[model samples]
Target: MAAAVTASMQPKSMTRAKKWDEVVENAYRFQLAGYRDEEEYRSVKKVDSAEKWDNGFVKKLQRKDGCFYYYNKARECSDKDVPKTKLYNY
Candidate 1:
């Protein structure tokens, strides 16, 4: 019981990062096509509570219109419309 509790309490250090990377990578690959079920993974990104930093957070792609880039400013996803390109060029 104690071991189980201890294990559960351990930080999920890489889990989130791994998931984030996967989402980004898939989005980068599929872009707007990911949304229409033309691609495998669903088009998804962090749209809310995005933060701005020294380097600035990159905006996500995969718009609802099948065209245009994500509208993001000051680390916040301001685009009322969905984006259709990768946050960064890979």
Candidate 2:
């Protein structure tokens, strides 16, 4: 009998840091500041990963609400005070 392939055997694509940055930027139009809360950063990171896996890398940060935002490259926030905002509105 032939061996069956499992879901885990499927090949997965790895996302690059640059692509992730683009996705995050598109979702939120602001400088990341590179100083986000651990939870918040992880949430955004998941979004980026999903986006990369599904739609490939793009220069935009897409929110769950389907909103797109842009980010600045030169400007950034300091670790002491990274901007914080609600993920979504109820």
Candidate 3:
């Protein structure tokens, strides 16, 4: 049985990443930023993860394992001050 299962395993023709992989990667970055941004703009707009996360990695960020990015990519983003908005305050 083990031999039969091993024999059935064949490599796929598309095992390597395609040139378009970069496009999906770019989309993933955009989606993550948009998701964080919409937190303040929920009344004005919505950023849909399904419509934006073209890459699998970005989508995985929602999963428990994917959260490892917090340690690996800690410098990518932060909660510092949340940036300035249009409305100024005294």
Highest-scoring model, lDDT: 1
TM-score attained by model 3: 0.19
Worst 10 residues of 3 by lDDT: 81-90
For every model shown, what is its TM-score relative to the native structure? 0.19, 0.26, 0.19
Name the candidate, 1 or 2, with the larger lDDT value: 1
lDDT of 1 by residue, 20-90 (tens): 34344333334333441212222133244222223444344444444544434342322332243233221
Off by over 4 Å in 2: 1-59, 78-80, 83-90
Per-model C-alpha RMSD: 15.1, 13.7, 18.1
lDDT of 2 by residue, 1-46 (tens): 0123234433344221222233343323322323122233335445
- Judge candidate 2 at residue 86 and give its lDDT: 15
lDDT of 3 by residue, 1-40 (tens): 1232232232222122133333334333333543222222
Best first by TM-score, ranked: 2, 1, 3
Stretches of model 3 off by over 4 angstroms after superposition: 1-20, 35-90
Q: After superposition, how far is residue 62 of candidate 1 from its true place, in Å?
A: 3.0
Ordered list by lDDT, greatest first: 1, 2, 3
CA lDDT for candidate 1: 0.33
* Clash pairs for candidate 1: 61-85, 62-83, 63-82, 63-83, 63-84
